[model samples]
Target: MQGIIHLWSLDATEPHELTTETLGQAQILGCGSVLHLLRTLSWVRTKQNRIAESSTKLWLVSRNAVGLERMQAQSPDSSRQDSSTRDSLAIAQAPLWGLGKVIALEHAELWGGMIDNPEVADVLVEIGAAIVSGEKEDQVAYRDGQRYVARLVKSDPLAFDGTSLSTENSYLITGGLGTLGLKVARWMIDQGVRYLVLTGRGVPSIEAQRRLDQLEEAGATIMVANADVSDGARMTRLFQEIEEKMPSLRGVIHAAGVLDKEILTKQDWGRFRRAIAAKVEGSWHLHTLTRAMPLDFFVCFSSTASLLGGLRLGSDAAAFMDTLAHLRHFMGLPGSSIDWTMWADDGMSLPSQEDGKFEDNDWGGSDKLAEYTMAPGIGLRILGTLMRKADTAADAVQVVVLPKDLSYLQGFYGDRIPPPLLSELYRSESVQPSGSSDFMEELEKIPVEKKRDHLATHIQSQLNRVLGFAPSQTMDLQKGFFDLGMDSLMAVEIKNRLQTSLGCKLPTTLAFKYSTPSLLIDYIATQILALESPEGIVTESKRAANEPEEILNKVKRLSEEDLEALIDEKVRF
Candidate 1:
């Protein structure tokens, strides 16, 4: 069954399982569902940039006439490059995946607005029915055999006369509706995102739906996606659905996890398996799914238990989990340093009470159980990293999350690699030197002449701020007032500053070579020149390459100028 359960997903779509019910898509003659349609549809828009390979222009805000005009105007290729742009007349816009939760939604009903070209607008308006339904009939056939139904639910930025994008972005809460999960979801909604997806082990109850209803009325696009994170197949399937259904997925914060703590000598074997499934294997599965995507970011929630490799799960559990976390980091799960997974006490699982005061655990004075378990900031930081690491709206980087700050609740579990391994992280790969040797110190003293050559630049820090220039740009400064025009003065000032700073009055022509600050810095450091020195042996030593055969060979080599010329054939650059 373990093999059979490798993959499974609730979001999996089958032809037989249609939407059957239009939850909120078409309510009360198109007004109620407009916001539902666009705000819940997930997608990512990519625009190739002449400058950056990953740059993309997302159609996130252009629902109003003026906004649409600007979006179209600024587009790199918005001309008649393709008639389909206008020919389509209507587009079935999906939900912007990363949009968090909508804070507001407003509409305009039939109050005619001005269009730059009234004739073109009239033509588009005249064919609206055909564009929405008549043409889409061949594609989006319904149970009743209808075409793409008449639905116009697009969101634009604030101040535009169309649907407004919540001031923030999109957010996904994998364990939405749970104690910690629900709180996190609500927090995101309050942050002004346009959409929120909630996933859990089960369907959200009526109470959860009521909360969502209130949130929706307040202008939030909310959804419920359920799956147990430990289920590898289900998780993989969920990721695929996100690609097809909600392409705008920025990143996932794996807040859904399980825990089992008992003495190693006393805990059952099944306890160990379940814990591994939740803490380690689940992390691996999420890590794998994220790797297959060009994601914004990904973070695995780890416990402080894994950090200390605490004895509760004993040495084996600690070693496995710590190694797993390190592997996760190696796979590019975000951060330059190994992040420690810490937690708050409230999120930890405990026994439910039976009509009585909460029974205290053995070693408790205060309620340290949750502080010992809830992964603090792991969820939020993963979310933050994904949102932050989004290189372009089109390409998102993945990250890992560990709770270090919440260690008061409980300490970590793992074989803490000693500082000895840390010290040798970047050691020499060639020769094995003495244990006490400082190879780095010896390497650093190789002398400037042996260093690599590089581009040099010079910058003049102005007495007055450069006003509009950034720190990396050059600033020209001259003594008193210059008799020359701006361009000439700049060149002269640059030359003098380089001379003063370097203490070597270089050729005026060299000023052109080191015009940039970065170039000037390179000029200062990367200086190289090779000088041929005689190779000789020192002192009385008994070693090979020193015996009579070697000495005689060296003497012969010195006499042979032809041998020297033969060796000079190679150039290293």
Candidate 2:
């Protein structure tokens, strides 16, 4: 690029084309650019920085006229590195996790989907600063056999300078390739971490490679290994391998977890006990494995289940929760003889089929449940803060993260779910179904035919029963959608049963609403016809509302995606 290109003025009707001499004529727009910069920053990073007691999102962007004009007058190539931060004091913190908004200089909404991973957050911050100073950043590499190109857009100074944390030593992630694991993996890079050891199950995909590339380009070298943290022998072997490759290891991030669908009665006694094995027992494995190794902090991702004494459905996990509570009580553990950890779930609330169920602004009368759900989350957070300061606390530090309503309570925290705010989808009603239906009963009704017409008739019958209306071969779609009250939750349930009985890939939304049996049957017929091999619906796990096999598979696959993807992969059975 020859000399330079500049044109901007919020006060003018059109962008002002200013040269070095006339640039001074431009009017200063108090917070226009500031707000825009903050929004953009939320898209890529979130500032953990605080100013005068406000947690703001920060970005380092190109300098402004006030600073740039002053610098150029001194030197032609003159520019200054700047810090940009936004305080999202008002927006729902949980939803806008990594975004900031500019209403007044008071606060910003840290976009949630964006900064789920710390690495992405860190890089965005650095980029924001570079842009503010009018400097070009080096090419950042990306995965998927390509590179992600980023540019420095012109912007003014941010009110608060972002904080810089030291990332000198190597870190170990127990569930290194799990959902949170992958995200935290790259986040380490953003904070100036140098090397990474990725441990998880499965072969790396294009996106996974791209992440490694991006992190590496951002100066974070990564290594990939597939191992189950629950297997101490394999874990020991992995550490030995890591020792041979990249020796400097300092921290451990334990974000692995196991979720159950029913109360203890619903599952085999031994089968349900595995939750403890994977979560709590796994933590012990990591603690003992690296006990003598040189390490700093051990961050374990405990669930809100422990704090809430576990839930009705997940109460069996109490033993695991107890393990965390007694991590310090257990001996032979490394780093102060106990694990310093962070217990995290979604937020103060739990993500359920009901999180989005409030039809009226009065919060839909679920405040009590929401309060109960969020309590453990707050406790987890407090524990985390204490755990980080473990040396000053009792023996170890512990923090917690609970779930919250993105649509309602994100403002209370410092995160936003990001828009396209709430997936403004206009789905066909034939796709929607009742979410909380009896799972086994639905499967029992499937006809013993291996064709679309058979499945179509089956759906027609079910629709007639549910809505108390029969239909012809074809019916109006609105009958299934609007009048019937179908939603995302119902859609999931319907689809699961449909796939099992119909032996086809049913649109997940079909169960939400069919207005009329006729319309829903029409949709099922189409999908049934596409099946390669439709099987008779013989659902298992009768005692428990176990996750649909397909859904579980999807979850397993999701544990391999990036951090943000991990956050998005969240679902409550």
Q: Which stretches of candidate 2 lie over 4 Å from their true place?
A: 1-168, 309-322, 329-388, 402-573
Candidate 2 per-residue lDDT over residues 390-482, each given as its tens digit: 333333433333233223222211121212211221112232233333533554455434344555556654433222234333334445332
For candidate 1, write residues 1-573 as lDDT tens digits: 000000011122221231213211211112122223322221111121111111111111211111121122222333322222232211111111001001010000000111221233432442353334532110110111111111112222112122112344344555565555555566566656656666677776776667777778878777667776667778778767665654366555555544333322223435544544443345446655655554444443333232222322222222223333333333445311112333344422211011112223221213323333435444444444334533332122222232234222111101111111112121222222222223224434654333222112123332111211233443333321111111111333344344434333333323233434444444444321121221211223334436988866776867467666656764422
Question: CA lDDT of each candidate?
Answer: 0.33, 0.37
The candidate 1 region of ten consecutive residues with least summed lDDT is 100-109
lDDT for 402 in candidate 1 is: 28
Candidate no. 2 TM-score: 0.36
